[model samples]
Target: MSTAWAGGTDAILERMEQMTSLFVEETRKSMYKGESATHCEECGEEIPESRRLAIPCKYCVDCQTALEKGSK
Candidate 1:
């Protein structure tokens, strides 16, 4: 009985973690939606047209890379 309860708790925790990740990702997307800037918000460098089209949000390539790295 104890083992069964522990397994069930573990499953619930795993599902909660997955849900939290999904929520964070969705929130990040929504925060950046409809945001387009010509320069990197972090370093004030000019953002390329290709990257602007690709990302459609703030931050240049280098800044974006750093931001992602820091997030991880």
Candidate 2:
């Protein structure tokens, strides 16, 4: 490949890597750092283990979505 084409490709690859890193960092930060709640604070629904592990959430997906929607 020509030097110019190689340089452009390198720049693009670098930018992509940076973006991926940023996205991962943001995702990690977004996850709750505190202990996961066993049940939904708003509703009496039991929070699933999978959801708790994925994110230490206080509410189930449905309730969380509703709360968010209502907040808007």
Candidate 3:
């Protein structure tokens, strides 16, 4: 490989690393925190205890899926 091509590859890798770090920081800031709800806030369905223990979720699995789809 040419010397110039090697240098360009290193620059590209450094830029990719910077972009990945920024994305990780943003995702960390947006993650759910605090206590998990016992019931689905949207559908009023009872959220299972297992679900509550699994993650800090405010809605049931079904409702969460619908909300994600609608957002897109």
Runs off by more than 4 Å, candidate 2? 1-31
**Which parts of model 1 are misplaced by more than 4 Å?**
1-4
Estimate every model's Cα lDDT from 0 to 1.
0.86, 0.86, 0.85
lDDT, candidate 1, 1-72, per-residue tens: 566676589789999999999999999889789958999889899999898887777988888888889962
lDDT, candidate 2, 1-72, per-residue tens: 567776588789999999999998988667665798999988879999999998889898999899779962
Whichever of 1 and 3 has more lDDT, that candidate is 1
Clash total of candidate 2: 0
Cα-based lDDT at residue 42, candidate 1: 91
Candidate 2 RMSD to the correct structure: 5.5
Candidate 3 lDDT by residue in tens digits, 1-72? 567786589789999999999998878556666788888999899999999998878899999899879962
Assess the local accuracy of residue 12 in candidate 3 as a C-alpha lDDT between 0 and 100.
94
RMSD of 1: 3.1
Q: What is the C-alpha local distance difference test score of candidate 1?
A: 0.86
Better of 2 and 3 by TM-score: 3
For residue 63, model 1's alpha carbon misses the true position, in angstroms, by: 1.0
Pairs with backbone N, CA or C atoms under 3 Å apart (clashes), candidate 3 = none
- Residue ranges of candidate 3 with Cα displaced over 4 Å: 1-29
Q: Which ten residues in a row have the lowest lDDT in candidate 3?
A: 25-34
